[model samples]
Target chain A: MSTVRVENIKKTYEKGQVLALDDVSFEVKSGELFGLIGPDGAGKTSLFRILTTLLVPDAGRAEVAGLDVVKDLWKIRQIVGYMPGKFSLYQDLSIEENLNFFATVFNTTVAKNYHLIEEIYVQIEPFKHRLAGKLSGGMKQKLALCCALIHEPKVLFLDEPTTGVDPVSRKEFWDMLDRLKARGITIVVSTPYMDEASRCDRIALIQKGKILELDTLEQIIARHAQNLYAVDADNRYNLMNDLRKNTEIVSAFAFGEEQHVTLPPHFQDEYLSAFLKEKGHTGIKVRKIAPTIEDTFIKLMLENQ
Target chain B: MRNLVFLLQKEFRQIFRNPTILRMILIMPIMQLIVIPLAADYEIKHISISVVDQDHSTYSSKLVNKMTASGYFQLVEYTQSYAQATKTVGDGKTDLILTIPAHFERDLIKFNKAQLHLAADAVNGVRAGLGTAYAAQMIGDFNREIREEWMLLPKFNEMPQIEITSANWYNPHFDYHLFMVPGILAILVTMVGAFLTALNIVAEKEVGTIEQINVTPLKKHEFILGKLIPFWVLGMVSITLGMIVTFVIFRFLPVGSFFTIYAFSAVYMFGVLGIGLLISTFADTQQQATLFAFFCMMVFILLGGLYTPIESMPEWAQWLTRINPPAYFIKIIRAVYIKGSAFSDLIPEFLVMIAFAVGFNALAVFNYRKRSA
Candidate 1:
């Protein structure tokens, strides 16, 4: 079953001068952990806001749990839990008070939904009496999630939930989402972190307010059609320059430890290594490697350009 | 309704928990109630005066003695020259100067009347006017005393038989506390209603917590209503507590029904909270909200007739006061308490307050924006 369906959605700011979301359309399957992968200003927040019924699209329709977003906003609010990109819990209220207040807003008790947020809540339960402002960043994120989940929303929209959190907390948060997904909650999460794309069941690579590609992680990775290699030499800058000058090389860009290069299908490694040695590139190393999500994202972006 | 109650509870808890804010809200009203009345009196007493006796005659000396004997003036200096006496008045060392000419008792006996030059500083018009009246009364009493002692009868041309008897209504004793305590309570209530709500909402926006609520299933109206109801109730609670203190310590109680006072105050509080919420919508930070709220409260209190009577204000000012919710509320509270007027008598003011409450609340909700999804 489709939990969320967005069609032909477009959002523009400053009276349509700046397009934040351009003809955005996608669907999230029920019980699936979906990811909207993009960098900052890529309309991730704009798209999330539309689907969550906090915003109205200029043209198009979106439905959460088969209800139109615009017509049934009240119903949509009851069914969907949204954790915004920023930590927005009440700072003056204690942790427990914040949780209770949100729960009361939804006409439910914390005790009723205590089981839903127990895993995340326990981490901060020791400091439950402390003001939400006084908590660490990680604790604040957990409290926000707890408040968002108090009503047992079927669809959770997390807009960059792990943006500023430490690596360990980020991992723990994704793990919590996985557990929530197991309980049949569909999660639509947006993040700029490329590494987190692999953790989602399906991912959409979006940039400049448009989706470049949308598919399962494995499928998106499998879509890379170039012969990719990592090349390292004593002079890395000269190596990149030398590779870029060769018309035979389709694309050559630096990765973390070495430079990743894409060559024509007919190019042979023996000939390339020999060609590098003859060009006074000593101690050169060339090895075939798998393309990462970021590599594929960059290649797709370049291909579109 | 349930949500509103929950929010109100949360707001009360938050306010009581923060000692600094709690003290600011409570201590200010109490101080205003206790100290402002004493500091804001119009009645004059114990004015310092300097006497310059150029003649040093029996009549001049007697006039000086008569002026000092009256409790209104305290004779602080006896100057020989007019320049020194003028300098004393100019330097604020004395409030007035009495210049007695060089005339013997023979002038008063022969001429049947003597002229005394009284110089008064008119820097403060009201005080100077009152001082002149007091001086005339004192001199007239002195002349009458002399005539009675000598048993000399003077024929009068005409005396008006029309008598004017004035009776001060409401507060007959003119107790400033009776008038001020209610006005102070109104200011405190307005402060809490306007300032606290604005600061609370703007603080959430500044700290990014508003984004958290924005993404939730909470409707914009629900969120705004949730925030306002608590502060409105709190403002009413503060007003009630202030009234209690007014009755207990100051021994001033309203003659009308407590229910009527609270009803109008409750409606007025909604208007104030709505204004606060409106200010919060426009401000991005707590500091901006605080300044905005302060500015609005200053206008509201000044025009609300807290300091001056609305009836005495100019026509344009009176029209402006018509829209001032506090002005109407203060009038209602004072009338109901002092005049024992019924609810029907305050129908117009009540209607205006209701209009403010609805108009401001609608503006607040309209200005409140949701996230651009």
Candidate 2:
């Protein structure tokens, strides 16, 4: 059964001048870890708000746990947990107080749902008496997650839960989500970081208020992957410019110190080396590379434009 | 039921944690009660007078002495020429100018009438009007005294004397503070309730906490009641503090039972707090909420009939006051504090307070959308 179903969702701002979400559709299977992967301003937050019942879509329908988001909002609110993109817990409230308050609001108790948040709670439990505003970014995110999970919600929606968190804490947060999935709670999370896409069971690559691709990590790469190569030389900038001018290269982008370029299938490295030597390039090295999620996302975004 | 209790607990915790709220609740009443009533006094005294006595007779000097003796006027200038006195008033040294004409005593004895030209600087309307009335009243008393002394009880004049004695009820001494304390208390409670409740929801919006609350199963009325109850309690605390301050400083207490004051205030605060919650619904940030509440409060307090009587106001202003919630509360408080009016005597105002309480709160709840548009 689908935990969430969204169809033809449309939203706008400033009296429809700015299109926030346009003709969006998706579904999350029960107990699946689904991700909406995009950069900032990709309408990730709008979709999350629609599913959480915090916002009403301009057109189309969305359901959470088999209830209409607009009509059965109160029922949906009871069964779903939503952590907005912003750090929204009360700043003046202590960490424990914030958790207890949310539990009580959902007609539960902290002691009753302790197991659900025990792993993440133990990490930050020492400073539970500290005001939420005083906690570090990682600790704050952990507390927010605990609050969102205190009710043992059937579906959890976390919008950019690890956006500003440190890498170590980000990995720990994903680990907690994986454990929650083990317990059969469907999770729908969004992230601007493309590396996080690989962690989701399935993800939809979205850009400019439209989903470019939706599939598992391996499938998305295998279907859209091109004959990609990573090339490096002493003068990185000059190599990138020379590679972009080559007619044989399909697309070229600077990926850190190397230039990742897609060329015609079965293209020989020696042919590129010969061409670069004639152009007075030196110390050139080329190797075939598997496409990353970022590489495929960039390619799809370019094609969609 | 459980949700409301938890929400109220959180709200009260937040209120106690904020130092600004503590200061507003504890210090505002004492400051406003002691300061506003003392400064808002309207009884005029020690009006500067410059008398120009051209008659140079015993009656003229006696009249000037009598004016100084009344204790309401200060004889700043006792010049002979009217121009000199006029110049003193022009320079702002004096507030009133009196010109006694030549042969002023002879005219009263010969023609049974006398004319004294009195010119007052009408810049400060209340002071000028009251000073002129005071000076004219002293002159009239002098005329009566002279007649009685000259004619020996009016047996020869064949005139019947009608004596008028009037009494000031409620406030026999006409104490200005007695009238002002209750009105100021009404305003203080109103400000605390409206401003604090106004800021509550918008602060959550600004900090992004309201988004978390909206996603929960908590009902909308539960959320609104959570916001209203804490501020209502604080408003009552403010009124109680104001009463204590009033009694301590002015030795004044309400003439009616304390039950009436609290009963009326409990209902009135719901209306004021409703207005605050209503403002919160229209604003997106704390700054917007504060500005909007301030605008509403300025209109409410100005036309509230605290400084000016509603009957004396222009027709349009009085019409506006009819809709102002604070105006109704002020009138109710004044009646209970001064007139010792019972609950039965104030049934109409009680009904109005109930209507306001129900009306504003219903609109607030109706406007408060759990889901964003």
Candidate 3:
């Protein structure tokens, strides 16, 4: 059975004025690391809340660990761990106390769950006496993960776990998740960072409370509809303006250090180069490159919009 | 049930760890117990007075001296004219004007009766009313003394006299603190339980720990009990501390059993903490929760009949106070501590508290959705 299952999960907040989730459905198999890649307010948190049994779907059903979310929420709560998008650790407690509290609340002891949390706990163990509020952001993230994982949950849901951490810590957090996945723990995490999407076994791209696509990392990139080209000229601003006026160009947007342009069907790169040159541009380079997840997301967002 | 103990442990640890909240838990009731009752004293004192003696007779001067000597009034002026005495009262220099008319001593010899006029500044009606009553009591004693001197005559057989003496039991002296301290104690306990319980939960909500707890397998009652039990214990401790202060300063202890006070306090706390938990569940932020607690506390105190008697309230409000948990508690504490009232006499109050405890806590747990679904 899949570790987590959601079917046509629809959620509307504020008496149907705001649709936080719209017929969202996906499944995560046991021992697979899945990623929900979207910007903020793309229903990622809502979807996670449903799977963890913290919220109910308006018109759908979901099951975690073979138990229905609504009918068996208590049973699901025992096996599913949720780290909300925000830092939810008790700030007044020390690092050791927070971990101990969570472990005991789960009807277990830190000694019983020590092996599961040892890898994450060691990083914060030296400052175990320090208050959770006094820890650095990376340390707080590590502490929250330790509290969530102390129960040895079958499925782990982490929402935007690395939003404010430094790049190094973000990389370390992903490595930690990778290590947990290697231990046969099913992990479903959400993030707006496109680069993190490649770290998951499968990824779902969501926007405006709807999933645009769901596939493996390689398959998502392989499914990009538009052929992308990097256009570099003497000036990026003037190049973007010139490229927008190009009849051969489909759409152009700045992509950091260069302008990425999509060409029309049955169009060649030389035609774009010739068009740019004719528009008072010189020393321009156009290179066809493989699409990153960011490029694919932008393409899908444009298509959806 | 197994998880409740662990949750309670965590709650106590968190409460004691924070210095500001810890101070509020440990010291606030003690401070208020010492200060609030002292400020709440209702004994009337220091009423300024002036005498207008037009008779220039011994009886008139004797009456003037008698009014000042009673210790409830201060003779600020001794005037010869009623107009001057009225001026003193109008100038806000005195509270009462005693007018002894001419032929005051001769009228008693001719017609066997005398008349005197006394004018009081009635701006503060309670003070004026109490001062006039005290003055009238002293003047009646003076009239009885003169009558006793006259009744010594041969044919005066003291016509059908009845003297009644009253004993104000439990608080014989009627010191306001004796009556006020227990009421304040009840209020302090109520406040500590309700305000802290609500604030503690909303603080958790503010820090986002509530979301973490909500996602756990903990039941709603477990979470609420864990939140409430600590404040309930602290509230009980505040009552104990307040009673200790009450005994130390006022030299009064509950004439009834201590068990009755603690028992009633525990039930009262259940009702109050449940209301507080309900507020925390309804409010999304600590500020909102604090304001809700404050507003409810106003209703609880005003309708609880803490400073005023419930019998004095409007008929509609008295009906509301029947359901107000604090009102039932304050009456119970006063009757038990002062009157040494037994449980049999408080059965109605106890049953009402039982209903409130069950009703409010059940409603709180019902409104408190662990699923947020």
Candidate 4:
């Protein structure tokens, strides 16, 4: 059964002049970890806000725990936990105080649900008496998560929870989420980091307020129906320009230190490498490469255009 | 209701944990109660005078003696020339100049009356009025005494008779401290309750914790009530401490029902908290909230009759005071403390305060935004 369902969710700001979410629709299974992968302003935050019932969508229906988001917001609030994009825990309050406050807000106690947040809370428990404002970025992030999970919510919605956090802490946070998933909790998380998408059971690639594709990481990669190659030379910039200028190269874009190039179906790498050397290019390196989620996202965006 | 209790607990923890806020909540009221009353007195005393005694007679000396004996005027300098006396008054060294006309004892014997020129500085209207009245009363008594002494001839009973009787009500002693202490207590409660709560919420908005609460299971009504109720209670506690100090140190206590004073104060505090929350909703930063709350408090306290009597203000100002919750609260407190009025007499003020509280609270809740948009 679907734990959270959103259908044709459209949200606009400034009297519908700017569309934050346009015809977005998706679902999260009862126990699956779903990821909404996109850049900033791609409507991920808006979608999370609508599902969490903090905001009413301009058009569409969303449900959490089989209850309508608008009509049963109070019921939804009691079952679901939410952490916004920013570090929004009470700063003047101590870490323990913030935890107790959120727990009490839900008519529960930390002692009742301490096991749910124990892994994340233990790291910051030593300094629980310290004001949250004085904590480091990673500590604040952990405290925020603890507060969000103090009630053992059935479904958790995190909007870019790892933004601004150190890479090590980000990895640890994902590990915690994976453990939570094992406990049969539905997790719907949004992130701009492409690498984080691989950990999700399924991912939705969104851009410009539209969902381009939604599928498993391997499935999305399987849909890259093109011959792709990575090309490098002593002058990377010159190599990229030459590849983009060539009519044979259908699409050429830089990826990390190497440039990813897509060629016509009939084109062969042996012929292209020989042709490059004959054209006065030296020390050329060409190799077949696998498509990443980011590459698939870019290709989708390009195909849409 | 459970959420409200938790929120109130959080608020109390926040207030007590922050040393600065705690000090401001407790210390400021005490300072205003003790220091402000002493500093805000309007009663005039110890007016300096320079006497230009042209007569240089026992009669003139006796008149001066009577003026000094009144304890309102002090003989600062004795000038032989009128110019010197005028200069002393002009330079602010002396508040008045007493010019005794040059007259022989034969004049008083022949005329039965003498004229004394009194020149008083009138820049401070109230002090000048009091000083002139004091000098006149002293001179009049001296004249009566002289006439009585001259009545050895047994014909003084033929003169015209004049009688003056004065009665003061409410505060017969005219103690300014007694009048000001209650008003200052109201102002202190207002600042602690409204200004502090408004800034606290706006600060959360600025720092982003409001969004955290927004996503939680906390309802909007619960959140707002949770934030306000604690400060309201704190304001009442401050008022109680202020009243206790007023009784212990100043020997002043309310003559009416204590329950009525607290009830009115409680309702008025709600209005103040609502105003603060309204300000918080509109302001994006703690600084903006503080400044706006400060501005509103100034207007409310000024119109609340803390300094001037409400009846003495113009009709338009008096009408405006009707909407001011502090005005009603101050009136109710003063009426209870000073006049020993009962609850029935304060029914109208209590109703106005309740209306203000409900109205402002509704406005605050309505204006609060749930979404960032």
Clashes of each: 4, 0, 0, 0
lDDT of 2 at A89: 99
Better of 1 and 2 by lDDT: 2
What tens-digit string does per-residue lDDT give for candidate 1 at B135-184?
Answer: 98898878777776566445653434345677879889887778877777
Kindly list the per-residue Cα lDDT of model 2 for residues B245-348, writing each as its tens digit: 99999998889989999999999999889888888888998889888888887888789988988899999998999999889889889899999998889999
Which one is best on TM-score? 2
Q: List the RMSD of every prediction in angstroms.
A: 5.0, 3.3, 3.7, 5.5
Best by DockQ: 2
Model 1 — TM-score against the truth? 0.80
Q: Which runs of model 1 end up more than 4 angstroms from their true locations?
A: A92-131, A221-288, A299-305, B1-16, B44-167, B201-229, B255-260, B280-284, B342-347, B362-373
Q: Which stretches of candidate 3 lie over 4 Å from their true place?
A: A233-238, A241-248, A270-286, B48-69, B73-125, B128-165
Error of 4 at B324 (Å): 0.6
lDDT of candidate 1 over A1-305, digit per residue (tens): 89999899999999999999889888999999999998899999888888877788999999999999999887888888888887777778999999998898788999998999999999999999999989999998899889888999999999999999999999999999999999899999999999999899999999988999999988988987667888999998898889889887888898876889887778767766987998899879998878889889988989887
- lDDT string for model 4 (A199-254, tens) is 99999999988999998989889987668888888877778777778887788899
DockQ (model 3, Cα): 0.62
Off by over 4 Å in 4: A128-130, A225-227, A235-254, A261-286, A302-305, B41-165, B366-373
lDDT at position B150, candidate 2: 77
| C-alpha TM-score for every candidate | 0.80, 0.90, 0.88, 0.80
Writing each residue's lDDT as its tens digit, candidate 2 over A171-249 gives 9899999999999999999999999998999999988889888999999999996888888888888898899899988
Instruction: For residues A1-305, write the lDDT of model 3, one tens digit per residue.
Output: 68888899999999999999999888889999999999999999989988888888899999888899999988988998899989999888899999989998899999998988899899999999999999999999999999999999999999999999999999999999999999999999999999999889999999989999999978988877677899899877888888887676778888888888888767878987888888888779999877788888988998899
